[model samples]
Target: MPLHPACECHTATRSYEFSESHAIRGSTIGMVLSKQAIPDISQNGGKHADFPGAKAPYVSKMKFLNEQSYDPIPIYRVIDNKGQVIDRTEEPRIDNETLLNMYKTMVQLNQMDEILIESQQQGRISMYLTNYGEEGIQVGSGAALLPRDMIFAQYRELGVLLYRGMTVTEIVNQCYGNHEDRDKGRQIPMHFGNKEKNIVTASSPLATQMPQAVGAAYAFKRAPNNERCVICYFGDGAASEGDAHAAFNFAATLQCPVILFCRNNGYAVWTPTNQQYRGDGIAARGLALGLHTIRVDGTDALAVYRAVERAREIAIQNKPVLIESMSYRVGLHSTADFSNNAFRSVEEIQKWAQEENPVEKLRLYLEGKGLWNSDIEKQFAKEARDIVLRTIQEADQKKKAHWKEMLKDVYYVMPQHLQKQMNQMEKHLEKYKEHYPLDQFQSE
Candidate 1:
């Protein structure tokens, strides 16, 4: 609120009040201007050297600010690691049905991740990224938003999609690249998108969705009485991308209604936060860029829900907000990342997995409220696992999209070049019909 409280720059001018007592104390006249003086001077057209870029009062001190000047931004948390609400007033007033749904969604996401990761190892899918310890950040924030609000996600936010009503079958179909997939078997596994759900398709390049989300938010801002806002999710690694800087600056300056959600899960692949950056974290960057910012404990679903609920309200008023959800990545970055050679030790992973697991934390909270028990947990776990397994089996049996389908979607009216290419492919496939597994693919 006071800018950088420890930094003796612009914040120093706004924080102090001008008084006769200060003059009596021989305080520098440059540092004596009160917060009320700025507006009064401006209204009277006083000869203050007002810079077009900055409106801060001139300060007497010549001091340079560094990372150590301010303390790290405190993370907001409604519940502790034991899943007990630290403050009753801070706890969100979620309905029992919604709470159960959120808990179940997170469990389902975890179950899906387990089977899918194993499936990847068994060569059932090409690749997979697990949600692991960040399920609360996904499901909690997802539940706080309106379904109509747009979402632009990085690879690891499957729980958000699940919470937004994406069926397990739809997800498995995409993973298997079956004919029923919304992308028509075009995209790689885990790069999910659904137009009906308002979630943009994930791309492999880091932070590519940031600017796109801001553009969409700008469009929503222009719409009269627009209630919708865009939520763009990325990992801490993605936050280091150049596109992230552009997106933040544009969102702040243009007053776009967007939430830049950063899952600061302790590592950018193998690199830890210490190696990633020197400053406080992604939230500090948002503050410097003029965006409303907050840091939340990613493992606490209730805290995440409360933070995002308030963020959405601010965003709808054309104020962009940045939320840094802090947690640890308890799993390997992806199936490609071998655990034995992982940068983090097994013990560290296990510690976070057991102590700060988002799903387990929510389960404890439910148990405390008399809303859950071992019986319910066992039943839901089995049901979730069965659903994922059944969906995977069905998806495996389904045929791949027709080979010709790929070239068809590129253009509404096929051009001569593409048409010739398609014809050539067809002729080649026909000649080698016996060599190719035609039974595994849909017929033309």
Candidate 2:
């Protein structure tokens, strides 16, 4: 049966048939079965074995399936690189307001990345990561989700937080680790979490959110008339982790309603996709794991929105889906790493940034629709920059979280040992107050 309209399962099936023919050609048992067969077992209403573990047809010949047995999964795309819709039928029926908001959010996200990355370079922030070329995947998927939907994001999905109503000030505060920050200056820059926004705090470890998101989905499944689903976002690099495989198996076996969204942005730090895995992209792994799978062109905003919208529909029906969004990381992995030094070329990054940029693609679409122009673009660009700069200024001026905040949140009640430690630190600070930057931190 056909799956999504953009899916090319037929091609996969045809490739598998061709490979199987070659695989069984030299086997004598296969040759004998071709010429002779036992009495039909279908007369008893069962042609395949009904084993406790699997229900599969019994083959007369031995065969092994490999990666080459199927064609690479086709990427689902609604628009071309020029931002023209490839299929009108496939275009999502998003309203002008929603479409405009998505475009604006992507633009804002791009602007934020530019400013924040520069801020890190200027020593304003300790570290940062940019969404860069993958803005469409973030905003498009964010637009498709409900406000109530829980999001488990890897560190790079700042656009999703912005779309989900996290304020610019809130983001800047987190980056600055100011007194107003929700995490009490505990996390690194870009590790955003808002309980009210339903986005879990991002951790530095790869793929840890996968199993946790599945556990949340299982809880939602057991709830009475559960209407919400969990969306777990990770990178292609994270998919290689054992936790990722565990999450996939448990989600498939327990039938959790979760969307395992993988951003295959060509590299995990300095390692490229070719070195990451030998098989087809991450979508192939999803297929083997028995999840509803789709590969999407992450640069096309419309395509991402349509793919995620459908994925959400399937997910809320108690089916887990995996979407591998393919794009390029036009920026460095983070402020800590430098690209174009060894692994990839600057020209290659420039090519993708110019021709396949998600922000520019959506801008072209909006321009074609008469919803955007050079004037609007300039105005919005200035406004976005002003807002980010203003937020950063305000956040930087704010006092840092109190020195004692580091020890306060670890326990519901301060233990005796912790209290003694806190007292010792307080006494040490009081004795050496002139040596430390006490004015920068909040007072006791």
Candidate 3:
């Protein structure tokens, strides 16, 4: 139950000294840990980091210095809540299209989520997950990566697929599990992937993508002159999975080009983030593994992009980076999860809706810069809604997967045993013509 033995934060007063000559370039910007004997805290509990601008400015540093070796990772912020640029240096150098696209993507994500959620409720679609208040983390991080860099996603990464030009038709069809669905109705709603875009198939299992990303990145290194890294996404809850920790350690040890992006929205399902872990959030785990790590404001798209852009650079060189984006969800975890009905309050969700909507936060910045207007906003919303409706209409016409698909991809050549079983099924269906619908399995 203790932290990793190599977790320097487990000690007091981390004994680290900088060696400029041996340093990894472009890193070591702040608090580079060097190997040395740490001094005893011999003070108050000594289980926390002592940063310069810690929450307690009044308390003396020595009084709180504990056995904890790592400091709280500083949050990198560029924009404020009112959409003002607080740090000019950290601003991402993006063109107008890039800037406008960020706003457009967020709006589209919201619109699509709304329509799909309605469909799920109406029984038209099986399930859906809303980006809600965390659209910035979804769209921003997606824009930061190149087409070749792979994304191993958690379920909530619809923004990433939408940004990469996944159409409403494709998304709707997948959710509808119709004939046009890419996976041939194999996966449930929201678990989509594009082979051409280099995105991995999203599975429902928690924390599985992190380790997969590392292995994929390792394989990428062996490819012919391939210059790419893997970006894996998971939630605060998935970070608790043992696979996540194992992936972190392997990533650091193997020196793979992978960025483990953790969306620390402060909850893993119904459990509040406070109950998730005792140490610093997901970012600290990356530091404990000695990987270059960063914490950023998830509500600020530019900040998330900046962190990921730099992380991509480091990852391309076969160095892993972990990013923790602090944000909150306005809606429940998913269509099946009714956290508000049981554990959360309506007022709490409403509070985030008004104060922390990432889409609105980015919209405010764009409007303030004279890049957006109410007219444009209305157009964005209206067009997104129309497209989703049209997609749904077309998807409804498509039929389900054919019978051949049942046994098709399981093997290059249908094994004799499976072939025999299929033949027997066909005969049985023929015998029960009234009950069995052979045409449904035959073809669309």
Query: Candidate 2 clash total?
Result: 0
Give each model a TM-score: 0.89, 0.89, 0.83
Which 10-residue window in model 2 sums to the lowest lDDT? 8-17
> What would the TM-score be for candidate 2 when compared with the true structure?
0.89
Most lDDT-accurate candidate: 1
Report model 1's TM-score to 2 decimal places. 0.89
Whole-model Cα lDDT of every candidate shown, in order: 0.89, 0.87, 0.83
Query: What is candidate 1's lDDT per residue for 1-444, written digit by digit as tens?
Result: 222222322322333565544455656454466565442212112223344575665556798999999999999999888889999988898999999999999989989999998899999889998888899999999999999999999999999999999999999999989899998889989999999899999999999999999999999998948699999999999999999999999999999999999999999988999999888989999999999999999999999999999999999999999999999988888888866345777888888989898888899999999999999899989999999999998988999999888898788899999999999998998899899998999886
Clash pairs, candidate 1, are none
On residues 355-392, what C-alpha lDDT tens digit does candidate 3 reach at each position?
77788788888988899999989988999889888888
lDDT of 1 at 431: 94
Which candidate, 1 or 3, has the higher lDDT? 1
lDDT of 2 by residue, 1-444 (tens): 222121222211111122333444565331223212222222223435434566576677998988798888999998888888888889899999999999989888888998998889899899999888999999999999999889999999998999999989999999999999999888999888888889999999999999999999999999847688999999999999999999999999889989999999999999999999998889988888899999999998888899888998898888999999999998889989865557888789899999998988888888888999999989988999999999998988999989999998889999999999999998998899999998999886
Ranking of all predicted structures according to lDDT, beginning with the best and ending with the worst: 1, 2, 3
Clashes of each: 0, 0, 7
> Candidate 1: lDDT over CA atoms?
0.89
